[model samples]
Structures are given as C-alpha cells and as structure tokens.
Target: MQDNKIKQEIEDVELIIGKIMQIGVLIAGAVLIVGVVALLVQGDGGYAAGAHPSRPLAILAGVAAFKPYAIMMLGIFLLILTPVLRVVVSIYAFIKENDKLYAWITTVVLVILVIAMLIGYFGK
Candidate 1:
C-alpha cells in the first residue's frame, strides 16, 4: 500500500514535469515565430553584420528595444532553459518524497549544469 502510494505520487510529479517542458517549448516556439514575423515585416534583423547580443543584459536590452534577433535569441535561451528547469523540479520532487539518494544526485546534477553554463558563458 505504501509503495503504491509513493509510486502514484511520483507519477503525479512526472506529469507536472512533463507539463512544464511542454509549456516551455510552446512558449519558446511562439516567441520565435513572433520574432520571425517581426523580422519579415521590418525587412531586417536590426543588427550589424556578424554582430549579436551574447550577454543576458545585452539580450534583454535588445529585446526591450524590440530587436528581432534578440527576441529570437530569447526564445533560444528559453528552449535551453527548459531542461534545466526540469532538473530543478526533479530535485524538489525527490526531496518531497524523502528520497535522499535521488535528491542528492539531482542536486549534484544541477550544480554541474550551473558550472557548465558559467564556463560556457565565460569561455565565450
């Protein structure tokens, strides 16, 4: 009985995680579409040849300025962020289930992901 209950709860958590991924992807796709439409209407990407916003602040500023490339980049960033969000949700779900081993494992994975992102951002 206890095992069945735990399994059910885990299933619920998985469903929530699936929904998160689905929504994230959908939103990112929509943003990308909007950016594409804007680019087409404007007849330009609004950036110099070979120039693009690489930093978060620059991206945000460009997005605020309604730059199509920045909007598309934001969409790409959100797409990349979706799986990382899933890992975070998994960590919370594991901790909630009192599953110490899985919780610690997920935490380590999250840490590694953050480290990798930092390295990539800085190495650029």
Candidate 2:
C-alpha cells in the first residue's frame, strides 16, 4: 500500500511537471512569435538603445510602452525561468515524498539557481 502510494505520487508529480513545462514553453513561444511579427511588419525592427531598460521592472515598463525588443526579451526571460520553476516543482515533489536527503539537495539547487539569477541581474 505504501509503495503504491509513493508510485502514485511520483506519477502525479511527473504529470504536473510536464504540464508546467509545456505551458511555459507555449506561452513563451507565442509571445516571441507576436513580437517577431510586430517587428517584421514595422520593417525597421529597431529601437533606441539609449531608451532600453537596464532591469526587469524597467523592461516591463518598456513592454508597456510597446517596445518590440522588450517584448521579445520578456519571452526569452520566460523561457529561461521555465527550468528554474521545474526545480521548484521537484523540490515540492521531494518534500511530498518525505525524502529528506533529496529535498535538501533540491533546496540547495534552488538556492544556487536563485544566486545565479541575482548575479546575472546585478553583477554587471
């Protein structure tokens, strides 16, 4: 009974992770396509580099201002974050399984992922 329960939980986690990745990729791809189409239609496909945002929030502001580059960059950002979120789901799965060792390892991996993101954002 216990073994079957664990198996069921593992299967459920796999399903959830698969769905998460699929949705993330689809959304990112759709946004990228739209941005590309917008750029192609405009013919120039260029923006003033001086007006480009230096951070995430600023990039969001740029997107709100209808900057094509920012929109495409946001799609790229979503693509990058997809795997990071997979690690997050894995951490939860590990916790649910009561596997302390795996949970700790996943937590460390999550921390490392976050550190890398912070460095990428701020270590300029």
Candidate 3:
C-alpha cells in the first residue's frame, strides 16, 4: 500500500512536470512566431547591422522597445529554461518523497547547470 501510494505520487509529479514543459514550449513557440511575423512585416531584422542584444538586461531593454530580435531571443531563452525548470521541480518532488539521494543528485545537476550558464554568459 505504501509503495503504491509512492508510485502514484511520483506519477502525479511526472504529469505536472510534463504539463510545465508543454506550456513552456507552447509559450516560447508563440513568442518566436510573433517575433518572426513582426520581422517579416517590418521588412527588416529590426536591429543595427550585425548587432543584436546579447545580455539579459540589454535583451529586456530591446524587448521593452519592441525589437523583434529581442522577442526572438526571449523565446529562445525560455526554450532553454524549460528543462532547468523541470530539474528544479524534480528536486522538489524528490525532497517531498523523502528521497534524499535523488534530491541531492538533482541539486548537484542544477548547480552544474547554473555554473555552465554563468561560464557561457561571462566567457564571451
């Protein structure tokens, strides 16, 4: 009985994570589509020649200014973030289930991901 309950709870967590990924992809795709459509309608890339915002704050500023490239960048950012979000949720679910081993493993994975992202961002 306890095993069955644990299995069921794990299944529920999986379902929730699936939904989160699905929604994240859909929203990211929609934003990308909007950016593409705007680019097509404007008949230009909407950025200075050979230049686009690469930093988060710059991207946000460009997005606030309605730059199509920034919108597309945001979409890409969200797409990349989906799996990170899944890892975070997995960590929480594991902790909830009292699975310290898996929770610690997932936490390590998250730390690695963050480190990689930071290196990628600042390495440029």
Candidate 4:
C-alpha cells in the first residue's frame, strides 16, 4: 500500500513537470517570434536615425543585440524537441522516481545556449 501511494505521487509530479515544460515551450515560441519580427524591422543596416552604425564598439553592440534574438529563435527550435524530451523524462521519472537528471539537463542546455550567444555577440 505504501509503495502504491509513492507511485501515485511520482506520477502526479511527472504530470506536473510535463505540463510545465509544455507551457515553457509555448512561451519561448512566442518570445522567439516577437524577437525575430523586431529584428527584421530593424533591417540589415543600423538604426533608423541614418547614422549607419560604424566603429568597433557600434559593431559589437549591434552584434550583441542581434545574437540574442537569433539565439532565442534557436531556443524556439529546441523548445519544440525539449518539451517532448521533458514528457518522456517525466514518464520515466514517474515510473522509476529517480533523480532529477532531466531537469538538470534542460538547464545545462539553456546555459550553454546563453553562453554561446554571449560569445557570438561579444566575439564579433
């Protein structure tokens, strides 16, 4: 009886995690789309002020801004798969009630993405 109760609790936790992941993916997708549209509106050139953003500092700043938006799009792409992974992990966790490895994995991927974005932005 105690084991059955534990199993039920685990399933509930997994269901909640899966739902959270789905919501996260949806939110990420929305942000990605909005960011892309904003970037596109900016055009290939500099600001609308007609200053034509020259100089190393200007270029770096421009790239830094651009990279994050681009990376967000990548996140949108990943989110599509991530939610699926989350669902699968959630199921596994429910069955086994093991360590929270999948959560950590998701966080690590996000961190790596952010770091890559920073490097792309600043390295430019």
Best by lDDT: 1
Ranked by TM-score, top first: 3, 1, 2, 4
Tell me the tens digit of each residue's lDDT in model 2 across 22-115: 9999999988887788778775434664454557997687678767777788888889889999999999999888998999999999999999
Candidate 3 off by > 4 Å: 1-5
Error of 1 at 107 (Å): 1.1
Cα lDDT tens digits, model 1, 3-84, are 8998898899999999999999999999999889989998877799778888888889989999999999999999999999
Alpha-carbon deviation at 23 in model 3, angstroms: 0.4
| Residue 87, model 2, lDDT | 95
> Which 10 residues in a row give candidate 2 its minimum summed lDDT?
44-53
Range of the 10 consecutive residues with the lowest summed lDDT in candidate 4 = 45-54
Cα-based TM-score, every candidate:
0.90, 0.89, 0.91, 0.44
Candidate 4 global CA lDDT score: 0.60
The alpha-carbon root-mean-square deviation between model 1 and the true structure, to one decimal in Å, is 1.6
Question: What TM value does model 2 have?
Answer: 0.89
Candidate 4 lDDT tens digits, 1-124: 9889888888777677768787878876876675567657765333554343333455446546764344344545556556656655554563465556765665566667667756866785
lDDT of 3: 0.91
- Please give the TM-score that candidate 4 achieves against the real structure: 0.44
Give the runs in model 4 whose Cα sits over 4 Å from its true position. Answer: 45-72, 77-81, 84-88, 91-124
Candidate models: Cα lDDT each: 0.92, 0.85, 0.91, 0.60
Which candidate, 2 or 3, would have the higher TM-score against the true structure? 3
Better of 3 and 4 by lDDT: 3
Clashing pairs in 2: none
Model 3 agreement with the true structure over 15-120: per-residue lDDT tens digits: 9999999999999999899889988888766788888878899888878888899889988998999999999999989987899999999999999999999998
